[model samples]
Target chain A: MTHLVSIENVDMRYGGASGTLAVAGLTFKVDKGEFAAVVGPSGCGKSTLMRLVTGLHIPQAGHVIVAGQHVTEPVSIVGMAFQNPSMLPWRTTLDNILLPLEIVERHRKRLRAHKAEYVEKAEHLLDVVGLKGFGSKYPWQLSGGMQQRANLCRALIHEPQLLMLDEPFGALDAFTREELWCVIRDLHAAQDVTIVLVTHDLREAVFLADKVLVMSARPGRVLREHRVPFARPRDLEITYDKAFNDVVHQLHGEIASARRAA
Target chain B: MSAVIEDIQKSEPARPLIARIDWVRASPWLYTIALFAIWEASVRFFDLPYTVLPAPSRIFAAFYQYWSPIWKNSLQTLYTTTLGFLMAVVGGLALGLFIGWSKVIYAGLYPLMIGFNAVPKVAVVPILVIWFGIGAIPAMLTAFLISFFPIVVNVATGLATIEPETEDVLRALGARKLDIMLKVGIPRSMPYFFGSLKVAITLAFVGSVVSETVASNYGLGNLMSSAQSQFNVPLVFAGLLALAVEGIVMYSIMAWVERRMTGWAHRSTMSH
Candidate 1:
């Protein structure tokens, strides 16, 4: 697989020079169509690394290259979902899903003429996420899990090359989080989109990602990278397997040691 | 299957229609009726002169006695207030959008805005009269000047307080500043705009009434002032009642609009 994203020896500092160093010499690469999860202790600058890749912030040193272009500004070929669903309160679920299409260039111009077609596409996505018939309801009318599902649909609606999730399932309960993991796994397989998930959940990382990258605590750097040996169409039952628990336990130990060295 | 059937059987019957109704929704009107009844009973028992404190019955009588003039004047007040409020809405939205579009503008103008708002609008009414002469223009100008501040402040706050997460989401999508404002800022500020409308409408009424009492030839304010000078306390109370009704009507309309437009914001689950 070809590399879709490459971050090289990046240094990021918050506030100013005399301020905190958030990331130090962070280097990693994600292959095209790869599902990569970055797992770290809390406050390990995992989110800052996401910012670097998305081009929301330029690193003080080194380069962030996505899809063979050096990112100097916010990249348009990326989609993002956060821990907070952050749906616009004035829009219904379907409208919220249609937001990126309304803003992105190619879709914005055609949206007026093809609104019915777009609406059908949005409803189809909702159906895939178990939100069928919820298109008419306002964000407030839906449950939290439903809103997040809608949010995911919104991110994917524009069909970008890369999808970035920043602790997307962190705010959900255990059962809902597990259910969404399957949803995301299915989406990744169907869409053939490269995904970079910033999360702290080891079980989630082990279950969903093709490769798990561990980051050290603050002034974070890539601590280790472990390629999951599990095959595709991973079942929830696989999580109970001894091999799955072993990989999780190994990463758990690495995270603990990283915290001690902090 | 038995457990499921037993669970269905154990469910309580539906509540009675009246019992299911929300009493809190009707509490306002009920409270109004109770207060009016108490006022009528107290004045009748005390046998007070109408000049001192008119009973609800005598106030209603006065209201009926001069119904035509009262209605005309009430319509006049409503028209002027609405016109002034419309002007405020336009000017406030533009200025608020400008102020909120950037941090520099917000910081530079916020203090000045507060100082301007601090100057009592009632004091400005006389100056407006002197410039434009005693009429509806001065009343309208007063309403605009007094009511526009809340709208500007509220709208600016709404724009300024766009969640950092929300901004990040849009920005990462390569959305331009104008795109963010058009797509998100204006729509997000709507709740705040409607909230400020409720506040500003009430302030608009105060502005109009103050100007009318001091300068205008029509409106319930002028009617009340004249009635007070003549010691027609019942007529004055009738004017007060008219103003109260108008204020309540405007406020309720704005509140209804707010709920209609921004219900998702306040009612949406916060768990995520």
Candidate 2:
């Protein structure tokens, strides 16, 4: 089976020739419709990896291929969400969600003709995230968690084949984060889109991903790749299992050592 | 914020008639009324000469007597200021977008703009009169020249402040430079644009008045200057009062527009 995303022997250096080497010799693959998570210590270039895959940065020494084509320019089939939702303060929740549709080509061309249909779709997505009746409200009217959910809806609105999330839940409270994890889990099952989540939360990774990859400190490389043995339709009860804690603890030990090594 | 507003609305049915008046919001008007009353009383008690300081009653009398000329000149001043301000909005938006679009343009044009803005606009009036040959043209151009700088600077600042992460999100979705600018940059700059309008409107009035004083035979500035020459001190004070009233009205309108256009920004920042 062809992986939806493949980064082969990728090396990324920030600044010029003499600057910091952010990531080196990194290789990873996520199968089509699979969910994968990358966890690492801070400054381990996990974000650099996201940039490489999203074609925001061309890898120095290797190639990144998505949907069987090399990423020379920004790949159009990717959707991204960052830590800060960063919704435009001017737009209503529904309008903000519809933003990508106005920019991406196929939808942009069809937008005026199908604006009501798009609004229906956006409102439906908002409902899915428990944001029904909030379509008319502006971003500032919503709480932080609500704004993040709106941001997620904005990212997913175009229904890109691949979704890249960089610490999307980092700013949320633990309970809200877990609530979003369930939302994301249901979204993954329903949408069947390939997802690559870059986060520092071990439980978040284990609870949602099919596979979890841990990286070493600066100039990051994949230190370990573990297949999560959880079944589909996971519940919060799974997190309390001894097996889950063991896996998290093991990964935590690995990251601690990686930090010391750096 | 909405919750509090809703609570007030819900409880309004039970409030007494006098208590229902939004006194907190009306405080500015009340304070102005009280200040004028005190000034009228003090002038009457002190028996001050009108030349040193006109009493509020004398100022009102002058206003009544010169209503026709004051009305015509006030209209002229308003027309010139509004026309100049509108031109500035258009010119400044284009110039600001041009300057803010790239670091190269920003670096190249910013210093030149600063130098131009630093040159006192009053000194530029005689030069404007020489080029445009007096009348309302010089006044209008001066207002345009004075007000355009703030709008340009503010819009540029707004456009230049797109968060890096936000740019990345758009880029990863295959948005081009122009796409990012139209979708994100312009809308983001609106709050700043509206804010600049408040400052620029005031400056436009200053420019119009300054040009009128030196170059024009119409407008409140010229009327005041001519009145000063005749030593019609109360009429001069009335002209000053008319100008102040005009300024307040225009400023309030701009403030209302700003609140309407960019209410979300203020709401979020001020939210508990």
Best by DockQ: 2
Residue clash pairs of candidate 1: none
List, residue by residue over B78-151, the lDDT tens digit for candidate 1.
Answer: 98898899999999999999999999999999999999999998899888878999989999998999999999
Instruction: Pull out the clashing pairs in model 2.
Output: none
Interface RMSD of 1: 2.1
Which whole-number lDDT from 0 to 100 does residue B211 have in model 1? 91
Report residue A8 deviation for candidate 1 (angstroms).
0.7
lDDT of 1 at B234: 95
Relative to the unseen true structure, what is the C-alpha lDDT of residue A155 in candidate 1, on a scale of 0 to 100? Answer: 89
Which one wins on TM-score? 2
lDDT of 2 by residue, A98-193 (tens): 999888888999999999999999989999988999999988889889999999899899988999999999999999999999989999999969
lDDT of 2 by residue, B29-123 (tens): 77888988999999889988998889888999999999999999999999999999999999999999999899999999999999999999999
For model 2, the superposed segments whose C-alpha errors exceed 4 Å read A116-120, B1-21, B41-47, B263-272
Q: Scored by CA lDDT, what does every candidate get? A: 0.91, 0.91
